[model samples]
Target: MADNLLELDTPVIAILRAPTAARFAEVTAVLQESGITAVEFTLTSEGALDALRDCADFAYPIGVGTVRTAEDANRAVDAGAAYLITPVVSDEVIHEGYRLSIPVISGAFTPTEIHRAWVAGSTMIKVFPASLGGPDYLRALRAPLPDIPLVPTGGVTHDAAKAYLDAGATALGIGSPLIGDACTGGDLNALRDRALALREELK
Candidate 1:
């Protein structure tokens, strides 16, 4: 499954971090038209798993984010998530994801954490708060560990998306920049536009 996911080489994972989950479907509908097929629902959001279940059958992949525990991983898997994402590297969650055959994107910053996450069986590494280091940071990480796939999250805008990818990021995790106010305000067209524009840049 991890290989299958990598093969998708999805340009971005549209992230929803709202306090409410009602708009999951709405945002998804708009993103779908723009060819944004990978989405992540943060556990910090209310009813995150419920939102996942609601859209489990969608044509795209749905991932659970902010997963910090084995229980969270289990719940996310039970909710039918295709993959799991963590804000911090959690070996328990990574092990759980491995057992479930679900890819876990463990978050890390320093080279030590990133390498540790990879050595601990993380399916991939997420460079959290990636904006602080930006593409240059990723370039540095890739210098010694070019084989480990990295996913950059936080402060990754459409304009900066390609730079990270070029720096060796296997994919991106775009949050509000992708979701924007469209989820709550029902202006999903904004998200559609962003998604479409991003796809154009990535392509």
Candidate 2:
């Protein structure tokens, strides 16, 4: 089920791609306070590894994103990532992640790629830029490849998460809409409130 893929009780996954370490921490605190149990720091973000280490003590599941190589996967593991998420499927990264006993979510856009990632030992197949296809895309993909666990990422909104779940996605990966831009001036209270609202909505 969906619960098996996350290894956590909650279905939400917060993507923290802030431009600075301070902003990353700020966003992470807000997400935790909001009751989200899963968080990911994209490698494209500055100080992402340090930020991951900073929040290692939180009760939620912490993970890293945009991982492309074995070295990146190892770095993320060393930084205390409970899981690894890649923007694209990489055998090297997936193999390294498995070696470290860290669950890997490999990004795949097509049924072929999804099946490939699943066969490669990926914990879940992330459908990147999922907005383009929306829930309908997942619904269509599920008909023939119902066995693959899919997590729709990129452009997923708080209001749209449940639809993806209903459409057969294992879970949802929320980014900018949830975390907002680091320079846009984030409001911890607002983020927390939104997160809480999202959790409630999911239920």
Candidate 3:
């Protein structure tokens, strides 16, 4: 499972927060077509689990985010999520996710929290609100903790993705900028075009 997580060749991880299952599927299709092979559906999104199940056949990996409890982790696993991501670190959630042999990306904002998540068995340390400090922050954190795999999420734009990768980020989780309100508005073609442009920029 860890290998699978690491095998996500594309650096961009789309964060989808649609309000309906149909919109989620449509957005996911657009992203997948654009070469983005990993996506996250936050639990706050309505019918997120069902959408995950609905897209189970897609070659791309599907994940759950904002998971704060072991129960939520289990729900994601049962729904066939390829991985689990949290907005914050939680030992119980990490341990439980590991027991199920699913990769976990636990969110953290500080050096201590990032290291703690790594020690707790997180597959990757997600630097939440990464735009606040940008690449310089990740570069500084990695100086002492070079071995920890870090993925920067939140407020990441196409240009920011390159900066994060240059700053030693193992991967990126892109929201709004990649999978935006165009999904809710039923403009899948626009979303697809945006995803394609993002993929090209990452390339």
Model 3: per-residue Cα lDDT over 55-105, one tens digit each: 888877688998999999999889988889999999988999889988899
Per-residue lDDT of model 1, residues 1-203, tens digit only = 57755755457878888878888877886787688877888888898888888886687768889999999999999999889999998989999998998999999999999999999999889899999999999999999989898989999987899999999998888988778887677577667777888888888
For model 1, the stretches where C-alpha displacement exceeds 4 angstroms are none
Clashing pairs in 3: none
Q: Give candidate 1's TM-score.
A: 0.96
Q: How close is each model in CA RMSD to the real structure?
A: 1.2, 2.1, 1.3
The estimated TM-scores of all candidates read 0.96, 0.93, 0.95
Q: Rate the local accuracy (lDDT) of all candidates.
A: 0.86, 0.83, 0.86
Per-residue lDDT of 56 in model 1: 62
- Could you tell me the lDDT of residue 38 within candidate 1? 78
Residue 94 in candidate 1, Cα distance off native in Å: 0.6
lDDT score at residue 153, model 1, on the 0-100 scale: 92
